[model samples]
Target: MKTKKYTLLLILASLFVGCEDYLDKIDNIEALTELDIFTDVNLAEDYLDAGYTYLITETTAKSNQPDILSGLVMSDEGYPGRYNNSVQERYQSYANGDYLFLMDLNLGVQQRDTPNLAVRYSESWKGIRVVNTFLENVDLIENADEETINGLVGQAYFLRAFYYHLLTKRHGGVIYLTENLDLNSDLARVRESYESNLENILIDLEQAIDLLPVNWTAGNIGRPTKGAAMALKSRVTLFAASPLANTNNDPQKWVDAATAASDLINYASQNGLYQLIDASDAINLDVGHGGADLFVSEPEKLNNYRKVFVGPGKSKVLPQEAIFMEVNDNTIGNGGLVPLPRTYLTSGYDIVKGNFNPMNIGATANFVEKFETKNGLAIEDDPSYNDQEPFINRDPRFYNAILYDGVPWIVTDSAPLNTSGVADLAVINENGVLGVDLHDPTSPANQLWRVRNSTGYRIRKWVPNGFFLRNCCNAEEDFYVNNMIFRMSEIYLNYAEAANEAYGPAGKAPGQSLSSLDAVNVIRNRVGMPNVNGMYTGSTSTLRERIRNERAIEFCFEAMRYDDIRRWKIAHLEENKKVEFLEMRWQGGVSAIYPTGFSFENVEQVNLKKTFIEKNYWWPIPSSELEAVPDFGQTDNW
Candidate 1:
């Protein structure tokens, strides 16, 4: 344990020393030790920042690589389009109940040299150790003021909790280590119970909340705040109350979760620190409609929701809606979630080609159907829903989050158009020259079957308006967006779920005014959608399904769904099923009813069914770790 700890410290120290050459600050690189870092405030702060490296940022959360094998692809929400890629194949194996592969991939025991294995289980321990070192030695700094010391210590507590939360979510209760372990310390510690581990995490979070400021200055924007700690507490408690963790269905657990969420809500409301970004906020903005047809009603509401994901770049202040975000100057070219656009189409339009392959994270029809219609009722329940025109008058968020047939490829001020004067389209019809075909083998569009419109649908939530493949290569138009980790909307949903389970749909936790139904409607109303349907909100059981579906839609590709289904213990039902796509064909002669002259049909992807077994709910413990500590038995059924 001491040797491993020193290795991690050396790696971080090497990085710090490399930067020191440019700053000309540190005198000795080879002789620098852990104690030296603590002697100076700036060096100690830099050491603390190394812990942030392990956090799952938006770009790395799903795809450890460029545009392949994202969490969206792993979940029922999407499909891995680049089937031939080795990385995607690895993800495919893990998604198909390959437990050993999952253990190897997550633990990185055998694949440490792999590029995308950034969030391995062992890496998290390294991060925990970095912060633990900070907490142990932060008092040694001499010149730093009380406020500075407190803030740094607060960040260390928050980071330790954050890393432990990551480990707990994936591997259940791991060996909880707070102090930096030395060689003499017990090397073979027992893994604690999940509940006990969660309690420890809550203790650290409470300390973080006590020490952290309400908000940091603009210069320190991305650091955790009091609200961030509170938000994390809300998340932790919500998971603790979930069925996977609380198998006994303890109502008190739900109450605790609801109280945590409501506490944050009350604090934000009183301080005016955060609020849901209103539809009116985007009314005067000049941003383009993110591929939504020009005719889509209440475009302002759509833009409002879209803006939340495609964040305000460095030019603008962070939106009040985002309680916490991973600050990075990310563009579509590098690690951003936006799928690579079709190269041929970009070249034909005289736009600079984007990166290597036309790979995409294709949205599954299973996920598309989860969205309720404009009236806030499921399509099967909504009598006005048009089966043939499935995309119309649905949830405004659907338009903002998904790109189906007939949606514009890009909505620029002077968008390139085909010879017919129509804007370039993401059509998946049977047109050999213009549209794509899922079945036709000889079609020219099938050359790279994994292009933007491959699965008949592409994710639009993270892809901002007026975004082009050219933006990746053009510095002038480079689109920089921040990844939001915690926001007000999520807190609302957390409160709603816990409140619903603790009390009834209309009931609230002790001393709280907001009901579960009210909390959900607040999210729905922001996007101009009607409130939760009366039919579904009558009881906690029924409303539980609605709130889950609301979370599925609201946080679509934000990398929440994978853990969500697992924690709810519904992965077996939702994940082990055939993946479906929208099969559309061009039928010529356009009309009011047959606009774009296309017909739609739901078709299952051939030979593709996502497999999730009972054992998959919890990831298996790494073989090496279990080998070292034989008493720490492997995860159940592995």
Candidate 2:
């Protein structure tokens, strides 16, 4: 038995068949020891790969309650649809704080039936331990050159900081650990202050930036780059400066965040690491499935915005707009959930038993109201916004992001790959018993008040059109959708937000070449939306509202809304209201063939009511951790 503080026994055993078998094969293959692992560059790299494996990209139906989905569902952005009883209860827990679950390492295991909103504290601790173990042993690797050593070691540092940031953000001032702990090591530790925790995180990120290269070769895609570290620093500082962390709402923290974001922007620009993808160049019409005229009319508009999320559509390679993302080759590391149209669409598509169901999950009606008109005016401000015809004359992003009633929908076999005249349209409206056929309730287009969309709208941001429809029909089929973690557009918004906070909307910071308006306009111009500077002039507070609105519009359903509202310290205001859903009244019957449009007359509240108490700003510290280490303290109000 080894007496070293850390042991590689269990981790190594997990990588192989059995511990005894691994030991027996060591003579034929390679010796397995801490010294052996450290001395061998390949073994050291394997350890880092283990560390990276825990990094989650998307919240799928299987692990139903990641913060990416929960955050939005808990916030005003999403409405719970056809989830199971546990998921429904989880949504209720978020709203009223009625039932809270303890965090466990095996929380999201398929065997476990209960839904868990919290990330496993134990898993996060394990991740931290893995990173610390790497940092401690990396120096012993002599086979690799200095640059290679630094690059790998720097990733470890960045990952350590990343896990710590997640912990601090979820449960403020968690027990901070750097060294790898073993059975004999002390486990009890007091919680650190949020400021101190952020400082430690920033220190690791700074080291990562200093050591990591700006860009890696094509072979090493998805590895954290220097820009990723810098971007992370900006995100951390931004959250730290928010009302939740900064009780006084410190002005200097805003400057700090602004400076950090500016550092990334300046570095990426100087190094030529990334740039905003031009709308024209971003469009790729080579879809796997779509009607002939799908890309024929206004192809530039349909293909431009969605291509960034799914890579340049045809080639499906990472666009320059991507700062850091998980690389997927369709066969492995891809999400099993297909985001099927039945969940959102009310069209006549076949639903094979065990293959697909109309599992409802759509955007909230309130979220759809945030989009601006094409003429740079809000729906409320623009006289052109017709409540009778709400879908028309809206932002182009509306078409890019949503598949509303009357919009083109090309289901499998409904349209060939090249036919372009027009595909079938979605029929998802029924006012009371008039529009729906009570006699034929099983019909696809008939109104489904029970299992259909809670909101009148369906999500279209991640859903690809045309050829993608045929390929992504069921979970068994593979859909290589890259779960985007961070993008350059988010950086632009972060800078605009921090810059506006640091130095009012119109004013520029010391090193800034453009004001907050210019930064926002860059994103707007990409989508062909009218510039913000030409709109109604307002104070810094007004511009602040516009910036927040822009973020909501640009990043809807991308899993950033929950944190955005909370960090802004407005969760209590926004979250407590009842979730609203748009109910349209079709002039023609639901079974009627083709219709021009429907009227948005019945916008009603959902059954669920969200309640955000003062305690909700920070998640509750899991009872398991609190009980295991008595010295560990609970988050306030838990």
Candidate 3:
């Protein structure tokens, strides 16, 4: 045996090393082939390890790479300093200037294009190919126990489903592949026939669900658990049933979505796959007050997501919201990341503050607003809530997201600042967009949206803790701040949405009951927000809109909003939402105006043409893929 040619194992665990210290060089292991490796379980494990490299391939934690790349980043959410290159790409698409993406442009009203779209798709396909290759050869393992064999196969199926989920989320009409398909025959265009692909994916996912174990023990932290499988099913089904899927008014898809989501939620609630973190400790855990010893500062180890992002407090390790996260060390070249919305800050400089910049994004408010309820109506909706202590009695997400005028952070400034001017500091970067004083004090370009080298008061959510400057790869304290890819709260929201849609299919109704509504209520009551279907709101749209708003407010800055909007297909603000401003006369007769708008049109000029054709309901099939296959063509309008 030639020691088995090549096998990828690091994908199975925390084995694929990306970071090397100053004195060390990353061991350049040539991609393993079947002939080189796979002699035994050890080599098989290596291949499994390599398979998961996708999860931990760290980008610059603080870099703006996610500004345009992440599925969750809205078009206008790209900040002033970050994604500067994207401005042209975005603008050109609006002009209907290219032949390549007009088909894509015809999808939605947006003018986005195929190049970037293709890149994302290509990346997904590459991973899919790797997993497919792994599945083809895994059966070659010698004398493996049936249980072990099934476990390995289950994981392979789950991976295939996972890849399909990503493709469907982005392009919609992805091709379905199976074990028996001829390789060349399979390489054909099927983007137009997305329904079949989705059906294919659903069948694979269901099989995976049956095969995967309910809970995984040690050596499986990073592996997809039964909960993950179901969660994905719920998410994908909901997507499939939604307007994005254009189910032709077939309520069956909705019923299917609801059933999957409800089933997943029930499993989670029963199995403790997810548990809500205490509200106060969701962000600011009282360690001295009996906080788990494990959460001294590095709460990431706790493996929760709620506390780490929207939640408050200075936890040493994992914030409470962790559901699933990729662990990174110095080996990954500084890749633990955070996606700060354009207006996320106590003011302009405080990254931790979540709500103060409500009006920063001109197109869509950088911050999603939760209104104070008056006569059971959102105070903002009633318009009278603004007059009565506007900030009081609003969504708890505001507190979780914003530090207000009185919040504080661990800043390098020796200045003795209370929370008073901290909020102002976040917004007052006259020098640059995210810098200290580049405004030229003369040119309009030097104004609000410009980058301030000194970093002005603008604190971006992407700022890794303790990073003062950018390096190719710098080890920062952010490695301590756990990266939460999924959390319990999200699972709850998933449950709610799924149940609302799934009711009838499960021999239930489309509204919340204890089984479904309990998830929503738990999160709502935890945050001190109102329940969705109650006597305290206006129309059903009003209440449902509140639900959507709560999800955005709760999941803000966590890379969920972009997809949430897409899945819901709600057209609020394209990039960012409107910035809210209130001219209030407080205490004295003298009145003052404060800006709260966070809309996107004010930020960047986004055309959204290439990705937005009248019939272009899906992202384009990448142009590169088109050339590879004889039958592949463009998407639609373009």
Candidate 4:
């Protein structure tokens, strides 16, 4: 019989080694062969853990990759603060109707070594290959019990489905690779239909749900559980039922999607495994500063929403609200969504105070207007809303998520400096000078420039009260931020969307207890906001608009807006418009009612109107992949 030698080392080394010499060099490392890895349970598990590295991290944003930013700047949520060469060439060009296939051939080939969206295409395939190799050989393990084997196999299935989901969502349909194909096997394969791909993905998720535990304990907390599989299924099915994929507008698709979400909601509720963090408990805004109010209002509801992102430390319990997340330690690159601060006093720059990349992402005025008033009325509909005093009496989430001209933030500069140790406010005077200056300047600049708030607002959802850049390096502080890929709030929103589409806004699905209106109220009531207005809840079309706006507020800067717009088939209408910014002029006589004392004016962003069209709905396949398989043509009209 031929000697069976599994090339597990070759699979691991392929990530770092060159394609030309990887096979030749990896065989020399003799200890990592198939027999050695499978016989030892620890070695076998280590092979499974290697697949998890492909999961996204905070460094993806800092590296300026297109995957994370494509969801932010490419949508109406925000734009880059500095339109430098990198941002203009890669991000701006794509947003302005330049075909991605052309950009892939030009820039993607040149910067193949770096992390970009084009590179992400190849990375997902490599991850799938790694897990497929493990699943094929796991049954041969000599030292593991049935429970151990089941867990390993379940994780392998989940990882494979995750990679396929990433590819399918971005490029429409993809070739589903189930087996570990050798070099001699057939390499040219045609792409499958979107429905065919979704069926295979659901099969793997069902297997994972049956084999995995409800939740992981101690050292294995971050791994996927049965609940994670359920949550992912909810997301996947919902996307498939949207207008982009279900172009036929099938009613059964929406029903299937609603049922998937209802399954997870019922399981979680019955078991008491997940619930939204109660808003009644007040969060201390002044952590180290002696319980001062710091002029920040509505601490109870604002901080309740804030705690979902800046999670409790790893030693303590995970936030019950976070269903699944990618957790990190005290690493400097872990500030994923937190914008770079505006000045040195706030630790915006590095330790030496030289490297400064300020506010790479800024929220647009168009997105800011989506947050309704506290009475659940649009700014135009509510008589209480005052355009002159725009920031007052809005939703508590708006205060927590946006950093406008005159918001209070924690100042980290110690004593002896002028604004040290107090919660300094972000003040923009009549001349438009920001209160905080650039790192080298002694005072605020004459005008807003690079690394400053460009779109009239900076994102503050992920940046907690006491957060600072220096905390990323200080392990003693025990500061950690999680990228919440899946959370309980999102599941509720998914159900509401699908339920409203299948049944009317006030109607429930066959067996579900809550109506679509009830599902949305659960999210709003948690944040002390009022229920949806009765006027909009009478029909599906009117209530659909309200549901989309709610998602924009609840999941802003969480990277869901881009896909939401496209899946709803509204990108052509929403994306083809100029970016708007708010300019504030201080009128001087400050009062308790109008604290900022500034008059706001809307201005169109110069030379930055987005140009999305019909072909922009789905990304094109890369040239090299299509070249390899002539049968696999490009996406429609690409």
Candidate 4, residues 274-309, lDDT tens digits: the string is 799877322223311123433453364356667766
TM-scores, each model vs. reference: 0.85, 0.82, 0.69, 0.84
Per-residue lDDT of candidate 1, residues 547-614 (tens digit): 99999999887768878988998878844256787766667756667654676677777566767787
lDDT of 3 by residue, 1-638 (tens): 11222132111111112111101221434444454344455566556555454431112122222222332223322222222234335435433434345233323322222223433344455455555655666767885776676666677777777767776776666556554233233344445467887887788788778777775667665566666677778777777877767547467786677677667556766776566665533323322212352112223322233235432322333333454554423223355433322222111222222211211221122343343341325544565454333344344444333322212344323221222322332232222232122113443542333322111212223333332212233322342334455666776666555555444112343443444455556676664444554542343344445556667656655556656665656434333322222221223222333223211121222333224333333455534445555365556653
lDDT of each: 0.67, 0.61, 0.44, 0.65
- Clash pairs detected, candidate 4: none
- Please write out the lDDT profile of model 2 over residues 1-638, one tens digit for every residue: 13223232222211211123223434643436667777889878877776765554323222322232245576677664444334465566566764245333234434233332344444456667667777877889979999999899889889988878777777788756676554555566688888888989999999999999888877787799999888889889989987788889789998888888888778888888768766733222322122332233234545656666642233346668777776543331244434322222221222112212333356777778888877778888887666655565566667666655534544334433213323322234333332221112353433332333446665666544432322333322323344566788887888888888888877665776867788888888887776884454366677888898899988877767778887888878843356776666555642223224444653556457677777877876656556666676777877
Off by over 4 Å in 4: 1-28, 57-68, 83-85, 99-116, 280-294, 297-301, 311-316, 330-359, 411-450, 470-478, 575-577, 588-596
RMSD of each: 5.6, 6.5, 9.2, 5.8
Q: What are the clashing pairs of model 2?
A: 288-467, 289-466, 289-467, 291-419, 292-418, 292-419, 292-420, 293-419, 293-420
Please state the error at residue 587 of candidate 4 in Å: 3.2
What is the overall TM-score of model 1 with all chains considered together?
0.85
Candidate 4 yields a Cα-based lDDT of: 0.65
TM-score pick, better of 2 and 3: 2
Error of 4 at 278 (Å): 1.1
Ranking by TM-score: 1, 4, 2, 3
C-alpha RMSD (angstroms) for model 3 = 9.2
